[model samples]
Target: MAVSHYTLPSAKLDKPAKLLIVAAPFYREIADDLIAGAKAEIEAAGATYELIEVPGALEVPSAIGIAERMSNFDGYVALGCVIRGETTHYETVCNDSSRGITLLGLQGLCIGNGILTVENEEQAIVRADPQQMNKGGGAAAAALHLIALARKWGGARKGVGFLPEAEELRIAGELKDNPTA
Candidate 1:
């Protein structure tokens, strides 16, 4: 079988931005490599990022979710590894984590998932290698792309002359300009 490798062109931002990396360090070595690559990519694009550690793969999405709700990160990178074993827990972790991240994206949060799902240590090492697959960098790029898209759509940045709901209703003739009642 032929293997295909794909990468997003480096994302260039229009302005300085902040990102957060939520890493699950079950495998410390692998997680470190992923974070290194991700940070490099983010900085290369003229952006800054803050890093935080979580317990395991399952918690990665939850950390991002909480940050999305209560923090100011412009984007997020999710880094972790889940290796398959004899038990079914691997599938649960991988599936639920991915689903959660997807849900957050659907809600319009920019997120890059660098979590590695592998069948063995060798595969994990190859995928996590900063000089090899560089999935971490890829994830950062994905987040940047989403951020760019959001900015393009004016996410929360209404155009000039945008008005509040009450003003808009009056302008649309939905309400009287001067009402006593």
Candidate 2:
């Protein structure tokens, strides 16, 4: 397997941020690990978070939307695991969930997607560990990163100032690597 490394950005925790976590219970084991990892990162960043369970991956987007509409959370983390099956149902769920989450981000809601789209259980196990470069934590990091950027950009607007070329390239790579909704 190819090795990959990520440098976590320093979290400015002068004021704790409120976070909402929407998790799918269908894949309980994997989802649990992802949640645990996210919780760890949230605490480490000096933030408070709440976890809300949903029936499955398909429900994550709606839950996030409702939470965003009703609550005052600074960000959201969506956690789920979707493993490939005999039919094309996996593809549909993956694509729709990803698109929905991406839309949420564009709508100015900070969302961290820890949803795992994999071929089997082994891959899920490897990626869910808190100490093993958790994608869950990575998602949380991305959310925080975006939140910081949004603030620096002075809230939502039709157009924004130019991002450093290197930073833009880095974000593009991250989005391509994990296309979750």
Candidate 3:
């Protein structure tokens, strides 16, 4: 089958950011390649990162959640490889891991998910290779993009509820003075 790729837009940030990389090295070689690519990408964007290893793909997301709660990382990169096996474990890992990441993202965590769910080792190698699909680098780029967006909108927000006392009094005075009844 033919493959197509579309890269997300990247932008320079106003300040450098820190990222946490949660990797699952069950497939050591593949995880190494993925981590290398992710590091290079983060460096290219003028950001720094810390790497932490978990047991497998399923644990990657939990690690990220822990770091988010306990650390001050600006973003996260999740890297793992789940090759289809003889049983249904592959499906569980792939689905639950992705779901966790998605939930974290919905909660406003900037994350790049590089977990690979492939049919075989060959496919995993092709996708994880920095010189090939470069999924690791792609994940970093995704996180960077999210960080930029968060910073761009990180400012004082206007409240939509009740107005402050001074403004309320001023409006009340105006209404009293302009009464047509």
Best by lDDT: 3
Q: What is the lDDT of candidate 3?
A: 0.89
Error of 2 at 69 (Å): 1.0
Tens digits of lDDT, candidate 2, 29-83: 7787888888888888888899899988888988888877677778889889899
Best by TM-score: 1
True-structure RMSD for candidate 1 = 5.2
Q: How far out, in Å, is residue 36 in model 3?
A: 0.6
- Candidate 3's C-alpha runs over 4 A off are 1-4, 155-181
lDDT per residue as tens, model 3, 1-181: 9897667666578999999999999999999999999999999989999999999989988888788767788899999999999999989999999999998887788899999999999999999999999999999999999989889989422232356776676666865664442
Q: Give per-residue CA lDDT, model 1, range 42-157, as digits (tens).
A: 98899999999999989988888788767788899999999999999999999999998888787778899999999999999999999999889889889998888888778643
Judged by whole-model lDDT over C-alpha atoms, candidate 1 comes out at: 0.87
Given candidate 1, what's the lDDT at residue 46? Answer: 93
What are the models' TM-scores? Answer: 0.84, 0.80, 0.83
